[model samples]
Target: MSIVETVTADMKTAMKARDKQTLSVIRMLKAALMNEKVKVNHELTDEEAQAVIAREYKQRKESLDEFQKGNREDLVTETQAELKVVEKYMPKQLSQAEIEKIVATTIAEVGATGTSDFGKVMGAVMPKVKGKADGKLVNQAVKSQLS
Candidate 1:
């Protein structure tokens, strides 16, 4: 099923189950997806839908970090819950070791010898890693490999 349909079905289920937190997250996702569709004036491919979900997940992670630093346990707990709900829609994340291996290979493939080649390495690596790895993790792996 398409992500929109899957989310719609899950939204109904959440409503029936009285899962308010999940319902709220699903609603936000649906809105984001719909807005993207309207913005682009076309139906979203599965990949586009995944991108939208990934963006939402990234936003949640940033919020989680801020809440943690601010020592807001209540907000941190709530953001963590929302993050879990958003993550259900993302592709499986790559482990750090797995990401490092890919970055190492790509660095060699691109002949990236130093930080000056960071863009070259990242350009080659990002498409390969894409939805499977977080960009921040991939960046760290690339920096470690180069420096």
Candidate 2:
């Protein structure tokens, strides 16, 4: 089934199981997906759905970090739970090694000899990594490789 359908099905399962946290996260994701669809005036492809989920995942991670820094353990735990629920819909994340390999190949392909070509290298690499890796990690890898 498609990610949207899977999310919907899981929402029902969460409701049935009385999983409040999971249900909330699933509802939030569904709303985000619906908003994206409405904005584009069409049904989303799997890649688009993944993009939406990735955005949600990114938000959760950011919140988790902030909560940790502030010593808000309760919020941190809640955001972590939400992140786990959202991550079920995302692609398997690439490891540091995998991202490094792809970044190296992309830099070579784009003829990016230094940080001067960061944009060119990033444009070429982002699509390849997309939902599979975090942008910050990819950027760090590219910078390390270029320098």
lDDT of each: 0.94, 0.93
Query: Model 1: residues >4 Å from true position, as ranges?
Result: none
Q: lDDT per residue, candidate 2, 1-147, as tens digits?
A: 999999999999999999998999899999999999999999999889999999999999999999999999999988988888888898999999999999988887888888899889989999999999999999899889988
Give model 2 RMSD, 1 decimal. Answer: 0.9
TM-score of every candidate:
0.97, 0.97
Among residues 3 or more apart in sequence or in different chains, the pairs in candidate 1 whose N, CA or C atoms overlap within 3 Å are none
For model 2, the run of ten residues with the poorest summed lDDT: 106-115
- Model 2's number of clashes is 0
**TM-score result, candidate 1:** 0.97
